[model samples]
Target: MLDATIASLSELGYSRTSTTEIVRRAGVSRGAQVHHYPTKAELVAAAITHLFHEQANDVANRLETMSDEELDTLDGIDLLWGALGGPTYRAALALAAASITDEELKPVVTKLLREFDETLVTNFGKYFNFNGEFESFWPIGLRFAFSTLSSAALYRELGLEDRAEEIVTVLKAMTSMTIKQMGKNSRQFGIQS
Candidate 1:
């Protein structure tokens, strides 16, 4: 059911996703779906939560194999773009936008988003390497990285693959510069290497 909801949101979008479509895609009865999720918002929220966990775990696993020296903003942006900027993110985005006016789903979606942010920060924080006075900028840097990369989804959907790549390349370069500045600032602040 959750899989179907994600698929529906990815392909059909939020306003078009219907219980009938979800159940049909899931190859399950309406009763089965209703028994599990009493409302569409609940089902969609759960789907978003499920995908969030999956993506978070994938990132954590990828990071586990890498040494600190092997990490950089360029590689980190690449990972984040590939990991969080495709169909899964599109699906989540749909639900997130819908949740704004969807009173029933708002709480669930907001809670899940907060949890996802916390998990992402905790899991990927070390790769950022913001030390000393640069620490406060860490979250803003990540938000910049993710929001910039994730924005490319719309371009890709519009068949603007080249444009999307161009934008990502530019953002990746800018992120590298920002990371370098952070390191320089940390050193200037007497943060030992």
Candidate 2:
């Protein structure tokens, strides 16, 4: 059912998603859904958590198969996009958008979002190591990279189709170049491996 919820939320958005739609898409009896989630907010929040956990596993599997050099290239952006720019993200984005007016959902979704951001940082550590404290610019740069890609996803979600690929391309280039420069700076300062 969570899968159906993710699909429903992604496609119809939070405002339009209904329990009936989820049950119909999931092909499950309404009884089963009610047994698990008595309310729409509960169901949607659980769906968001489920999708994020699935994304984490997908990212870990991809990281395991990718060579370090491949991970360091523009392909890294592709990997991140795979994790961040999909049905799950769209669903979560919808939830986030709805949260602004959904007092009942606001706290639950907000906590989940905070946890998701921390998870992203932890996931990055599995791929790369920094010798010491990050430069002040480091976190901001990383946020810029992710947010830029997220903005691209928003473009696609909003039907601004033409700019999506173009924005992603630019983000990939900017992130790759920034990573290279950071590596160079680290080596110059004897802070790298």
How high is the CA lDDT of each candidate model?
Answer: 0.77, 0.75
Give the candidate number with the greatest lDDT: 1
Off by over 4 Å in 1: 67-69, 182-193
What lDDT does model 2 reach? 0.75
What is the per-residue lDDT of model 2 for residues 37-104, given as tens digits with 9 covering 90 to 100?
A: 98888899898888767876777778779875565535656777666666788887888889999998
What TM-score, computed on C-alpha atoms, does each candidate reach?
0.84, 0.82
Error of 1 at 118 (Å): 1.8
- Clashing residue pairs in candidate 1, if any? none
- Residue runs of model 2 more than 4 Å from their true location after superposition: 133-137, 176-193
lDDT of 1 by residue, 1-193 (tens): 8888899998999999999999999999999999999888678777888988888888888877766555655666677777856678788888878888989888888888777777777776755666666678767767776777777866776788899899899996666566566557533322223
Global fold similarity of model 1 (TM-score): 0.84
Clashes of 2: 0
